[model samples]
Target: MSDLQFDSSSAGIGEICKAIICLEIAANMKHVLFDRQTAIRLSGMSEKAYIRSFNVMQNGIGVKNTLDIKELAIQFGCVRLIPLVRKGLSLYRERFIASLPPSRRASADFTRPVFTATGFYLCAKKHKLKVNKNKLIELSGTSEDEFSSVSTSMKDLCHDVFGVSTEKKDPKSVKVNRDLLDVLPEKRQAEDGGYSSDEGKDV
Candidate 1:
C-alpha cells in the first residue's frame, strides 16, 4: 500500500482505458456476421417478431449503427456479413460514380410513381437486359406519360445509380446496360455456372 495520488492523472488514465475497451468492442462487433435465420436463432425471435421489434427499436433510436445486425439483414440480403462487406463496396462505388462529370451523371427524376434508389434496384432485378418505356412504366406502377416525363432520370440512373450502361436505340427504345449488369454477383454466378465457386468462402 503506497501513497495514492488523488490527482486528475488517475481519472484521465481510467478514461483512456475505457476508450480503448470501447474501441476493441466496436471493432469486434463490426466483424460479427449472421444471416436472418442465424439472427433469429441468436435473438430467439420469430421472423415476424424480429422485424416488428427491429422496427420499433429503429424508430425509437432515430439513428442507426451501420453495424446493426437487423438493419444489415434488411439492406444487404440475409447473407452473413454481406452488408458489412457491401458497406465498403458501396462507398467505393459511390465515390467512383460521384467522381464522374455532370454530363455523364444523367440526373433525372420521375414524378408519379416516384422513382427512388430502391426503384432502380427493383427495376434492375426485374428487367434483365433491355426494356421499353411502357414496360418500365408498367413495372414501376406509373402511367406511361409519367414514365415518359421522368425518362431522363431513369436513364441517368443507368450509370449514376445502377452503374449500368445505356443506349438509345431510337425514340422509343432504350437498351439496358448488360455490360454493367453482368457485374452483379447473382448474374455473375448464373453466367458462370449457376453458383459461385467461392461460395461459403469466409471473408
Candidate 2:
C-alpha cells in the first residue's frame, strides 16, 4: 500500500467495519457511492495502490468490487447491519474509555462528543433511509474530523462486525426503539432568535 493508504489488506477488524459503515452512509444519502475519487481520498492512496488494496478489502470481506450501489444500500442500511454496527461501535468506545488514563476519560465525555453508530442508526431510521454524513455533522454541531473519527473507529470494535450476511428482509416488520432518539441534539433558540443547531441549515 502507498504511504497515504491504510493498508486495507492488513486492516484490523475495526478498520473494515469503519469502511463498510462509511460506504453504507455514502450510499444511503442517495447521491454518492464510495466512488473512485472518494475511495482514493479515503484510502489516501494513488489510483493504482487503491485498486490493489480495494481488491484485498473486497476479497477479505467476501464482497465483489462491482457491487451494485442500490443493492449495497439495501444491504447495509437494513436492520441486520444495525446491531452489528452498534455492537462494534460499543466495543470500540469501551476500549477507548479503557485506554484513557482515568482523568482524561472523565473530561472526554463532554469535550469530545462523537457521532456514534447508534446515532447513525437512529438517523437512518428517522428518514427511513441511509443518512448523509454532512447533514449529521451539521446537526450535531461537531467538526468533520470528529465525525470522521467516529466513522473510522466503527471497525475497531469487534470481529463480529465482519462476516455478516446482507440478505434482504421485510423491513416493515421491524420495530424501532424510541429510546435511541437521544442521539440527536434538539433544536434550541439563541438570543438572536435563530436556530442554535443545524435545524435550519441547508442539507
Candidate 3:
C-alpha cells in the first residue's frame, strides 16, 4: 500500500471514487467485484446515488491513513461491505473450487435457468399449497414496482426454486453442491435450482 496520506476530505466525489479504487488495490480484492445491485437493494439509495457514494468512499477514507475506516464497519453492519481481504477470499474460493468435481468446477461461473411458470405453479399446487403471487414476490426478493419484466424474472426465480426447472434438471437431486452452497455465511443449498430451504442444516 502506498504511504501517501491523501487529504481526500477536500476532494470531490471523483476523488473519493479514486480512494475506493486505491483501497481495492491495497486490500487486494481485485477479482471480487463490488456487488452494487445487492448494495442498492439494501441501501435504498437510487442507483445513481449508490454508485456515487461507493465512489466517494473508495477515494476518500480509503486513501486516508489518518482516518479510522474501521468505524465504518460498525456503521455499515454487514461485513460484506468492508474491504475484502484478498488472501482470505482467495483461499476460500480456491478451496471450494478444489472441492468441486471437474465438471462442476468448469461451470461455476455460469448459472442456467430452471423452469416454466406453469410447471412451477403445478408443482406448488401438487404440494397442496396455493401459489400466492405476493408470496412468490416475498420469496424472490423482487419488487412489484416494475411490471412485466420484473414479474417474469420473479417467475423464473420461482421456477428454479420449485425444482420445475427443465434445464440441467438433476432429478436425482443430490445434496446441493457443497462448494456453491457452503460458501454462503450460512451453509445453504440451492434446492436443485427451485425449491426453498430443503433442510435447515444445509442452508
Candidate 4:
C-alpha cells in the first residue's frame, strides 16, 4: 500500500478507503456480475488511478502476467460487447496459441493483446457496432496489416469452430433487357407519284 503513490491528504485517504472497500467486495463476491466502470466508480478514483492501484494489489497477491479483457474492451470502445469478445477468445484460445511460432508460444508475452484485438474486432463486426478499425489497431499496438491478418485468421476460426459465417452476403442483382428503335417522320407524295410542293422544301 505504501508503494502505491496516493496523495497524502484527507481526500486521498477517502479514496484509498473506497478502493479497498470495492476490492474487498469484489474478492468476496467472486461470482457477482459487475462492470469495470462500476467498480471504478465505487473506488472513488479516476479510471487510470483505479487501474494502477488494482494492478499494484494484483501483483502484491502473487497474481502475475494477467491480461484484463474488460479493460481492453473499454480501451477499444466496445465495453458493451465484451461478452462476444470473451466468447471468441475462449473458443479460439487453443487454435491461436497453436498457430503462434514456438518462441512466441513459449512466452506468449505479446499474444494476449493480439488475440484480444482480434476478438474485439470480430465481435464488433458481428454485433454491427460502428467501431473505428484504425482506432482498434492503434489501441492494440499492432500494425494495420498485422491486425488485418489476425482478423482474417480469427474470422476463419470463428467459422470453423463456432459455425458462425463471417462472410458478407451480397445483395441479389437483376438483369434488365431493352430494345431501342429510331422513328422517322412520314413523307407525303403527290397524286401523280411526284413529290408534293411542300415536300423537300425548306419552310
Candidate 5:
C-alpha cells in the first residue's frame, strides 16, 4: 500500500455520500444567527452595496402619504426582504430622535409635548413633506385654552411616528415604535404573497 497510490474502490462511494450528508446536517443545526447590521456580510450581497442601500432608504426615502413597497423591495433585492428593510428603517428613526440636543426636549405640556418636535421631523422624512415647526404651530394656533386637546394629539403622534409610549410618566422614557418601519398598509398589504398579473392565479 505504501508503494501504490491509495485509491477508493466503487464501495467507497457509499461512504463518501454518508460523509457529505453528515456535514450538511451539522451545518443546518448550527446556530446561524445574525442581525440586519450583519446580514449583508453573511449573505451573498457585497458590503459596499449594503451600506449604500441602507443609507439611501433611510436618509433619502420620503414618507410622503404614499407607501411604495415594490420600489422598496427592489431596493432591498427581493420582495420577500421587506421585513429586513424595516430593521434598517427602525434604527434610522430611533437614531434621529436620539440625536436631539438638550434644549430641544419637549416642554412640560403633554399635548404640546416636546417630542412633537421629533414627530414633525419623522413626518417630514417619511412623507417627503417639508414642515417647519413654527408653521405647524401657527396653523393649529395652539392656544392655552386648547392645551388638553393638543396634548392628546401630541400623545397620538408619539405613538404613531416614534412608537414611544406616551402614557409613561417617567422623564427618561425611551421612544419606540411597535410596528416595523414599513410603508402604509395600503401600498404594502395589497402586494402580499406576490405574483405577476401576467401569471394570474386569482379568479
Candidate 6:
C-alpha cells in the first residue's frame, strides 16, 4: 500500500469524501435518490460517522436558516395543503410587516415554529380543512400557548386584510346605529353640493 496519513476526525475527510461521492451519484443518476442507508453504504462511511457529519454540517449552516415550511407541512401530514400553507405564509408576512411600526419593522422577526404553525392554522381554517391544532403544535415543536398567541394574530390579519371574519355573528342581535345613520344624509349632501366648512375661510 502507498504511504499516506489521513486525520479523518480533525479534517472531516470522511464527511468530505461522503459528500463528494453522494453529489457525484446524484449528478449522474438524475432520477435516482439515495436514502440514508444507501448513501452511507455507497459512501463507505459508518452510520455514526455519517450522522455526526450531517449534524456538524447542519449546525454550521444554522437550523433556522435551513428550516423549510414545506418540509414541516409534510411532517405534519399536510402535504396536500402545501399551496395553501405557502399563500398563508406570504400573506402573514405582509400583514406582520404592515402591523409593525417603521422602526420596529426592520428588526421584526418571528419564532419559526410558531410562525409556521400560525400560517398552517390560518390557511387550514380558511380552506375548511379539518386539521388537529394539537398535532400541528406538536409537529411544529412549539408550545400551545405560543401557537395560540400567534394564531390569534393571524386570525385578526385574516379578518382585517382579507375581510374574512373568524368569529361568529349573531344576526338577531344586530341593531342599526341611528346616530350614525342621521349623520349620513348631511355627509352625502355636503359631498353632492361641493360644500366644505373650510371653503369660505381665507387662506
Please report the candidate that would top lDDT against the real structure: 6
Q: Write down the RMSD of all candidates, one decimal each.
A: 20.2, 18.6, 16.8, 28.9, 22.7, 22.1
**Over the stretch 1-203, how does candidate 1's per-residue lDDT look in tens digits?**
00132232322223333333233223323543223344444555544434333322322323222333344334434334434334433443344345455664454111212232223333433334232434333333323333333334344443333334554323123432222211123334446764343321101
Model 2 spans > 4 angstroms off: 1-77, 106-113, 117-131, 156-203
Local accuracy by lDDT, each model: 0.34, 0.39, 0.34, 0.46, 0.32, 0.48
Least well predicted 10-residue stretch by lDDT in candidate 4: 176-185
Clashing residue pairs for model 2: 14-155, 14-156, 18-155
**Which ranges of candidate 4 are over 4 A from the true structure?**
1-68, 75-77, 97-110, 160-203
Clashes of each: 1, 3, 14, 0, 8, 0
**Candidate 3: which stretches are off by over 4 Å?**
1-84, 110-203
TM-score of 4: 0.40
After superposition, candidate 6 runs with Cα above 4 Å error: 1-67, 160-203
Candidate 4's displacement at residue 3, Å, is 25
Give me the displacement of residue 112 in model 2, in angstroms: 6.8
* Quality of model 1 by C-alpha lDDT: 0.34
Off by over 4 Å in 5: 1-65, 74-77, 102-203
Kindly provide the TM-score of model 3 when superposed on the true structure, using C-alpha atoms.
0.22
Residues 1-203, candidate 4, lDDT per residue (tens digit)? Answer: 43353332422335554456345435423423334555556667755454334433433443323236787567557788877677777766555455555665554333334457667767777777767766554444334444555565566545543234755421122111100000000112223353333221101
Q: Report the lDDT tens digits of candidate 6 across residue range 132-200.
A: 776665444334554555665555554432224656433223231112111122233346673233221
Predicted candidate 3: what Cα RMSD to the true structure? 16.8
**Cα-based lDDT at residue 124, candidate 3:** 44
At residue 53, candidate 3 shows an lDDT of 44
TM-score of every prediction relative to native: 0.24, 0.30, 0.22, 0.40, 0.19, 0.44
Among these predictions, the greatest TM-score belongs to 6
Candidate 4 has which clashing residue pairs, if any? none
Model 2 scores a C-alpha lDDT of: 0.39
Full ranking by TM-score: 6, 4, 2, 1, 3, 5
